[model samples]
Each structure stands twice: as structure tokens, then as C-alpha cells.
Target: MTRSFSWWAALGRTLLCLVFLQSLLGKMGGFGAVAAQMQQRGLPIPAVVLAVSMALMAVGSVLVISGWRQRLGAALLLVFLVPATLVFHTALEDPQERIQLFKNLAIMGGLLLVIDREAPSDRPVRR
Candidate 1:
């Protein structure tokens, strides 16, 4: 039973790793265009935010894929994704936009599932 659980956990982690890695690659490849889009959208701190996000996604994906410090990597990845889901992928009046919006939401839901078993509040907080 334990062995089966381990296998399933590993498979789930692998799926998450692949998704995160591909997303990181896409973001890196289109950094310039994303920055331009941010600017067009009148987003504040466009360049700085994009640069930080690129770093977080790239490095965090690598760590998550390697299963080294996975919890930390997942935490970092969520920081970028939560805001991205709200800011960039919000549902608008267009069908295409709604699809994109739900895509991010779905990804976020997957990430939440793949994260540490205990929610953050379940962890001991140090003063």
C-alpha cells in the first residue's frame, strides 16, 4: 500500500514538473513580448515585475522538477501564478478570453493539489 502511494505521488509530482517546466520555457521565450503587453496594458512596474517573475518561474521550475526543496519551489511558483491568474487571465466579455481565464484557474487548482499535503496554516508558525 505504501509503495503504491509513493508511486502515485511520484507520478503526480512528475506531471507537475513537466507543466511547470514547459510554462517556464514559454515565459522565458516570450519575456520581451510579455513586457510589451504589460506596457500596453498600462501595468505599473512592468519590466521589473516581468524580470522577477521570469527568474522565479525558471529557477522554481528547475527545483520543482528535480524534487529538491519542492515545497519551497511550489511556494515560489504560487506567488507568481496567483497574481497572474487574477491580473492577466481575468475573464472579460470575450469567449477566447474566458477560455484563457479558466485555463489559468485550472492550472492554479492543479498547483494547489500538487503542493505540500498540509496547508500553510497547518504548519507551525514561529514568532
Candidate 2:
């Protein structure tokens, strides 16, 4: 890849992982609060879910940033994002919640692009 393409791709991947990294940090600092929020959402095994979510976010962010198993990372983020959007941001009656839902959707769109992009190993030989 050319230098420009490499730079842009790295920037894009970093930006995409930013939200997950920030969220994982926040969740780490307030595990109880996150678990409580999960419980309030009527989710079962709140603690387990919280732990798993954190793990996915951390691992997914690393994978995306390192450009290794990036599609798997994006998939993991989707697995986390889908239910999060439904459970936390589905209150269309509230404007803020509606915006949050759209924000999550946009993030998912970015992730889909990342997932669809060809990995180095998947690229065919040019010569």
C-alpha cells in the first residue's frame, strides 16, 4: 500500500476503535454502575453480561487497531452494539435517545465498512 493509503487506513481504524476504548475505560471505572444499568434494562445475568461486553470491547479495539483479525473485531463490536442500541437508545420518544440511536447506527456502518474491506491475506497477487 502507498503511504497515503496506509496513513488514512490507520487513522480510520483508530477513530473507529476510539468509542470502544473510551467506553471500556468508563465501564472499568464504574463496573457496578454499568451492571446496574444492565439490570435496569431487564437483562439477565447483568454482571456476566457486563464482563463479557467489556472483554469484547477491549479485545475488539486491540484487534482493529493492530489490523489483525479486524473483521472479527468489527463483528464483536456489532455483537455488542446491536443489543446496546436496542436496550439503551431505543426510546424514540426522546430526542436525545433518538440521536444516540442514530449515532450507534453510524458507528455500526463504519464497522461494516471495516468488516467488508479486504485483509492483506485476502488480497490476490497482482503480478
Candidate 3:
């Protein structure tokens, strides 16, 4: 790959993980309220769930951003994404929830692409 391509690949990975990064910061900033929201949503042990979610977001985003074990990172995020989408974005009557569901689905598609993608280091260098 050309140097330009490498730079763009890195930027794409970062963009793919931007949502997770921003969400991790948001959750950290509003821990109590977020946990309470989770509790209200019928999640068991909201605090523990929130903590685990935060860990997955932080670690998964880092792994994806760094392009190290990126598939594993995307998988971890998928684990978080599936349930969160089902539990939180299920109100089809609400247009906003509908939008969010589709957005999460789109992110899932991107993450799957990440998982399927060959690592840059694994690719043969072009002359």
C-alpha cells in the first residue's frame, strides 16, 4: 500500500471507532445518570452492566484504533452493540428510536467489515 493509503486506513479505523470513544467519555462523565437509565430500562445490576459496557467501549475502541487484534475488538463491540440496540432502540413507534436502530445496524455492518478486513501489516508490499 502507498503511504497515502496507510494514512487513510488509519483514519478510517479511527472514524469507525469514534462513536465508541465518544460514548466512553460520555458514560464516564455521567455515570450515575447512565446507570439509572439502564436500571429503568430493566437491566439487571445496572451499575455492573454500565461498568462492563464502559470497559468494552474503552478497550474495544483502543484495540480497533491501534489496529491490534482489531477483529477481537470489533467482536467485543458487537457483543455490546447487539444487546444495547435491542434493549434501547426497540421503540419502533418513535422515529428517533427507529433512526437509532438503523444507525446501530449501519455501525454493525462497518464493524463486520473491520472484522473481515485483512490487516495492513499482513498485506504484501507493492513495488
Candidate 4:
């Protein structure tokens, strides 16, 4: 790859992880609020789930930004996003909620692209 391409790729990776990195502060500082939100949604073991999700986001963001095990990082984000989108943004009656749902979906799509672009060796072998 050209030097410019390398620089752009690094920038893109950092930008992709920005959301997760920014969220870490809110998640860490407002742990009780996040847990309460999950509990209100009727999710089981809200505190444990919130903790695990925060950990995954933290680790995944680091991996993605550093371009080490990026596919795993993207996969972890995707896993967290899928359920989060469904559980938190399912209120079709509220326009704001609908918008948030689509935003999450778009983020999921980007992560999917990241996962798909992984190196061939990073992918599982076909039978």
C-alpha cells in the first residue's frame, strides 16, 4: 500500500473506533444509569450485562483503533450492537427512537464492512 493509503487507513480505523471510545466515559461514569435503563427494558442481570458490554466495547475499540485483531473487535462491537439496537431502540412510536434505531443499524453495517474486509487468513477456512 502507498504511504497515503496507509495514513488514510489508520485515520479511518481511528474514526471508526471514536464512537466506542467516546461512549466509554459515559458508560463508566453513569454505570448506574445504564444499568437502570437495561433493567427497565426487562433485561436479565442488568448489572452483569452492562459490565460485560462496557468491557467488550473498551477492548474492541482498542483492538480496532490499533488494527490488531480488528475483525475480532468489529465482531465484538457487532455482537453488542445487535441486541442493544433491538432492546433500546425498538420504540417505533417515537420518531427519535426510530432515528436512533437506524443510526445503530448504520453503525452495524459499517462494522460488517470492516469484518468482511478482514484479511483472508483472518477468516475461517471453508470446507
Candidate 5:
């Protein structure tokens, strides 16, 4: 690849990686708080469900950050994000939280675009 291409690719990938990391770490660490909030919002299941969501988020985020298993990661993440956007954000009448939810969709869009650009199994993450 040309030097400029390499630079651009690296920059984009790094930004993606940062987003992935932030999401993964946040969900992992914030499951309890998130669960409580969910409970307050009247999720049918127990707060334990949030733990499952956290796990899914962690897996997707890790795959994304590593650029490993891109297709699967994107697929799983979309699965997680769909309900999250709908139940928590869409259900809300507030604009700011909805905006935050939209931000997640935007990140997911970037991830999907990246995954589409690369063959899912072509190469493992270099790092």
C-alpha cells in the first residue's frame, strides 16, 4: 500500500479501535449501573440480563478493536444495539438520551463500513 493510504487506514482503524475499546470497557464496568437503570425503566427480566448484554457488547467490542472476526462482530453488535436503541432510547421521550443512542448507531455505521471494506476472514488483527 502507498504511504498515504497506509496512514489513512491506520488513522481510521485507530479511531474505530478507540470507539470499540470505550464501548467494551464501559459496558463491562457499567453493567450494574446500567442494569439498575434498566430495572428502573421496567425491564421484564431481572437485572442479570444486563450482564448478558454486557458480555455481548464486550465480545463485539473486542472483535472490532482487534479487527478480528469483523463480520461476526458487526452482526452481534447490531443485534445488541438494535434492542438497546429501541427499548431504552426510542422508548424514551427525551431528546438528549435519544441523541446518545443515535451516536451509537453512528459508530455502528462506521464499524459496518469498515467491515464491508475488508474481507471478514482475510487477515487477523496485526496487534
Candidate 6:
């Protein structure tokens, strides 16, 4: 790839992870409140779920940003997004919720592209 293309692609990857990274940072600052909110949503073991979600966000963001394991990273984010979108953004009556739902769908689409593009099965196995 050309230098410009590499730079732009890296930027795109970083942008794709921007939301997860931001949320991870926010959750770090308000862990108890976020866990309590998860509990209020009827999630079992809210603290554990929140911790796993945060770990997925952080690790997935790193993997994607570094381009070392893009498929796995994107898949991890997809795992997090599915339940999150359903649990938190399901208030279709609210305009903001509708917007958030569609936004998450778009993000999911991008992650799918990354997974397909970075499929390790398509590459030759290293000895």
C-alpha cells in the first residue's frame, strides 16, 4: 500500500474504534453507576458483565487500531454491540433511541467489513 493509503486506513480503523474507546474511558470513571444501570436493566451479574464489556471494548479497540488481529477485534466489538444495542437502545418510541439503534447498526456493518477483509483463512499459513 502507498504511504497515504496506509495512513488513511489506520485513521479509519482508529475512527471505527473511537466510540468504544470513549465509552471504556467513561465507564472507567463511573464503574459503579454503569454497573448499577446494567443491573436495573435486568442483566445478571451486572458488575461482571460490565467488566467483560469494558475489557472487550479496550482489547478490541487495541487490536483493531494496531491491525494485528482485525477480524478478532471486530468480532469482539460485534459481540458487545449486539446485546448492548438490544438492551440499551431498544426504546424505539424515543427518537434518540432510534437514532442510536441505527448508528449501532452502521457500526456493526463496518465491523463486519473489517472481519471479512481481514479473514485469516484467506491468507497463507505461516510455518
Worst 10 residues of 3 by lDDT: 1-10
Least accurate 10 contiguous residues by lDDT in model 4: 1-10
TM-score of structure candidate 4: 0.86
Instruction: Provide the lowest-lDDT 10-residue window in model 6.
Output: 1-10
> How high is each candidate's TM-score?
0.72, 0.89, 0.88, 0.86, 0.68, 0.89
Number of the top lDDT candidate = 6
| lDDT of model 3 at position 121 | 75
Off-target runs (Cα >4 Å) in candidate 4 are: 1-5, 120-127
lDDT of 2 at 25: 94
User: Residue 65 lDDT in model 2?
Assistant: 84
- State the lDDT of candidate 1 residue by residue for 7-99, as single tens digits: 666666677667667866776888888888888877888889888887778776766656666677777888888887677767588788788
Q: How many residue pairs clash in each candidate?
A: 0, 0, 0, 0, 0, 0
Model 6 residue 27 lDDT score: 96
Q: Sort all candidates by TM-score, best to worst.
A: 2, 6, 3, 4, 1, 5
lDDT of 4 by residue, 4-121 (tens): 2367767887888788878888999999998998899899999999989988899888887777778899999988889988888999999999999988888888788878875655
> How accurate locally is residue 9 in candidate 1, as Cα lDDT from 0 to 100?
62
Worst 10 residues of 2 by lDDT: 1-10
Off by over 4 Å in 5: 1-7, 91-93, 118-127
Q: What is the lDDT of candidate 3?
A: 0.90
Pairs that collide in candidate 6 are none
Candidate 2 lDDT tens digits, 1-127:
5223487888899999999999999999999998998998899999999999998899888988888788899999999999889889989999999999999999999999989997557789898
The 10 consecutive residues of candidate 1 with the worst lDDT sum are 1-10
Residue 63 miss distance in model 2 (angstroms): 0.4
Cα lDDT tens digits, model 6, 1-127, are 2222378778899999999999999999999999999999999999999999999999999999998888899999999999999999999999999999999999999999888883435667789
lDDT order of candidates, top first: 6, 3, 2, 4, 1, 5
> The CA-based lDDT of model 4 is what?
0.84
Quote the positional error of residue 33 for candidate 4 in Å: 1.4
The Cα RMSD in angstroms, rounded to one decimal, for candidate 1 relative to the true structure is: 5.6
What residue pairs clash in candidate 3, if any at all? none
Candidate 5, position 120, lDDT: 32
Deviation from native of the Cα of residue 100 in model 1, angstroms: 2.3
